[model samples]
Target: MEIYALYGPSGTGKSTSALALAHKYNINAIIDDGLLIYQGKKVAGQSAKYEKTTVQAVKRAIFFWEEHADAVKEAINHYPIERLLVLGTSRKMIHRIQGALALPEIHHYINIEEIRSSAEIKAALFDRGTQGRHVIPIPRIQVEQDFIHRLIAKVDKIFSPKKEEIGETTIVHPQFQTGKIHVSELAMKKIAIQSCEHLPFIESFRKVKVDITNTPVVEVDASFIIHLGQNVNDLANTIQQHIYDAFLEFMDLEVEQIRIVVSHIQIESPAHA
Candidate 1:
């Protein structure tokens, strides 16, 4: 396979601009932060961003674990990829990744400064330093299964200069520092409750259980009473959709499973003459 490298310092928006660059060069796949992305989907390997500490994160990114390296290598060999873009914080890092994956010498090297303005780089640095947010060039659903629960995943849309939609990216803050931010169980339940309240057919929620046990992958169990004459199955589906959308759009949390159990049905009586 022909290998291309995008090299720059950390927190310089390389991942943010990767999709646009890939599109510009007609590259079919990308290797970023220990994940393999093709056609805007994550097809192989776990993300280094899921590591708990900065040291571990770095190691994971460089393919320190044998299993991680083997998995990515195997995927690369299995796919019919002709051109691949490898992202790294420096040229040396790119070489390490290329060697680890057994890829051929990089045909070209593209610097972050070449594609992004200084102001853009500064903004990305500030966000990384202050908020600890990192961008992954794959859609949220692809990584939601393995992403840690404490981190939030926001969908980021990238567009070319011509305003053509390139692809979707995900922003997440990994647990690489002490005193990492937490999304409380109560807060998640509140989101679920609010979602249920907005549905016209839902009279009131009997219980809203937000399960964060597996986290970043949440399971919601809700019990509610619906207004009479409403199609039970239809309303249940609507409620599920609303809750799913609310969590993803508002909280950036992925809801893996939503179970709606009808506890009661309320009906209004005819007025007396």
Candidate 2:
């Protein structure tokens, strides 16, 4: 596989702009913070951001643990990757990840200075130092389950010059500031059910499944039946919007995705046949 590196100091917006860079370079897989990201999905390995201390986080990032190294290596072997991007603070750090993953020698190097302005770097560092926010190149759904104490936020959508949507990035606070906060799956299900309770055409919710695996940014799968004569498309859209708005208003949490499935439709009968 062809290998490329993006080298820079930590918190210099490397991770923030990783997706756009990958699009420009045509790299399909990325190795960042000890995770293997393919096509915007995390397929294997735990993130270094989950480490409790800076030293341990560094160790995890460079694949110091045998299990960690082996897991990422296995994932690389499993996927048919053509080109890969390795992100790190320095060439030495990139080389360490390369050796750990047994990838080819670096075919190209892209420096943070080439991509981000000095002002942007300063802003990023300020955010990192004061807010403890770190960017993961994958989407929020990919890393939500792994981050409990951290506040997770999704980066805005990026587009190529031609207007092709590249993907998204996630901001996370890795260092635990407060104790772990737990939001139960049942609670989320209730929220989903309650949100759609008042919709005109929604007869009843047949099944509601809330995935807290990705905490803070939750994914809801709701199966319900709607009254006949109701436009399925319109009902689905309204239900999705209601659930999303409800979560944001009530819990102050972002709804990453809501999938509304119409399992049945109720048709009203005339007085006489």
> Against the true structure, whose TM-score is highest?
1
What does candidate 1 score on TM? Answer: 0.64
TM-scores, all candidates, are: 0.64, 0.63
Question: Judged by lDDT against the true structure, how good is candidate 2?
Answer: 0.77
Candidate with maximal lDDT: 1
- Computed on alpha carbons, the lDDT of every model, listed in order, comes to 0.78, 0.77
Model 1 residue 60 CA deviation (Å) reads 1.0
Task: Give the Cα error of residue 190 in candidate 2, in Å.
Answer: 47
Alpha carbon lDDT at 264, candidate 2: 69
Model 1 regions lying over 4 Å from their true place: 177-273
